[model samples]
Structures are given as structure tokens and as C-alpha cells.
Target: MDDKKLVKTLFMVMTHRNEQVGLSLWNDNPQGYNQYCQWQTIIANPRAMGLGKRYIESDLNRSFNIPNPRTYEEKRA
Candidate 1:
């Protein structure tokens, strides 16, 4: 089977660490879960999640494409 065919949807669970709705969807529905070959949950900021904060140094959402990454979030980006 084509690798592409296995993933019907790419669920990108970004930003909020406390949010488990996306993971719950992946776990609750076995039939739907099978459609995705890869782990669907994409946690954008592990540091923020670990710290129980929205971000460490800077807002991750706005840190992307930064030339000189000075902050933790910027470095992650």
C-alpha cells in the first residue's frame, strides 16, 4: 500500500500542552486511528508543556522563521 494512502488526515495538535482533545480523538476511535500510519499528535512546544506554561522565552506561534533564535521558543522554531 502507498504510504500516502495510509494517512487520510494529518492532525497537527499544536501550541496548548494541556489540550488532549486531539489525542483523545486519535485514541477513542480505532477505526479512524487506523487511517493514520504515523502518530497524529504533533506537540509543537514540549518545553512549554513541561513547564506548564504557554511558552518558555517567547511565544512559539510568533517565533517561526526567526534568523537569530535567542529564546527557547525561537530556538525550537
Candidate 2:
């Protein structure tokens, strides 16, 4: 099979979950998608694999150069 044919034959799926928001997926159907299922398993058990947890009070994207860092959040900036 050509590249296009092979790609078409393969099954693909993507899923995401946000605590503040909700669950989402690119392919709503997951039946017979072994690779996709394996990926979800890894994501679900991230802590078991030594992954870091998300910050609660502060956003990592907001930290940048500032004249004065007064508060704990500011110091992180």
C-alpha cells in the first residue's frame, strides 16, 4: 500500500481532559483503536510514571520580566 492508503487504513484517536473544563477528543469513536487506548492509559496513570502536577494558584505562562516581585506569585514571575 502507498503512504496515503496506509494512513487511511490505520486508526487514530486523540483525547484531552481539563479539570476546570471537561473531556474532549478528536475522534469520538475509540473502538478497535489499540494505540489510542494505550496512549489514554499512559495519560491516566501519569503520576505513577513520575510526572509533575499542574500548579494550582499560578499560571506558568504568566511569569515574565517585572520590575518588582512583591508577592509569592510575583517572585515566580
Candidate 3:
């Protein structure tokens, strides 16, 4: 099947897990803003296709607001 067909199949079957709504961060610098948008797109679409960026044990979505992070993932927050 083609890429579009694969994406459609994934969406229809609901096999994806921990799928959160895509969020784009704001960047003050023009170049930085563009880069942020690009990165967000890169990460979001793959997850939409059932390819999550982080392992099932880690939740990148929850990493951002963490305080005094301990694990590598928390520090990555």
C-alpha cells in the first residue's frame, strides 16, 4: 500500500496509543519559529502514522512541565 493508504488504514483501525493532539511552541526569533514548526511537523506526523517518537515507557508530552527531573527523559523535559 502507498503512504497515504497506510496513514488512512492506521487512522481507521485505531491502533495508535498515547496519541496526543499536536502542539506547536512559540519562538520569538523568526528562524527559530520556523525551525520549531518544522520539528513539530516532523514529530507529529510520524506519531499519527503509529510511530511514536519516544518509547512506550516515556511520555514526551508530559516531560515539558516537570520539575527537578531525575530520569534522562525528565531531564530532557
**Deviation from native of the Cα of residue 76 in model 3, angstroms:** 1.0
lDDT of 1 by residue, 1-77 (tens): 56767755455443656665565554554334444464444566777677777677788779889998899878877
- Candidate 3, residues 1-77, lDDT tens digits: the string is 24333321111111123444332221222122232232212232334335543433345456567767765445544
Q: Which run of 10 residues does model 2 get worst, by summed lDDT? A: 14-23
Best candidate (score: TM-score): 1
lDDT value, candidate 3, whole model: 0.35
* Per-model CA lDDT versus the true structure: 0.65, 0.31, 0.35
Enumerate residue pairs that collide in model 1.
none
- Cα RMSD for candidate 3? 14.8
TM-score of 3: 0.28
Tens digit per residue, CA lDDT, model 2, 1-77: 24333322332211112231211332333333343232221122122123233433343345346576553334544
Superior candidate under lDDT, 1 versus 3:
1
User: Residue 7 deviation, candidate 3, in Å?
Assistant: 31
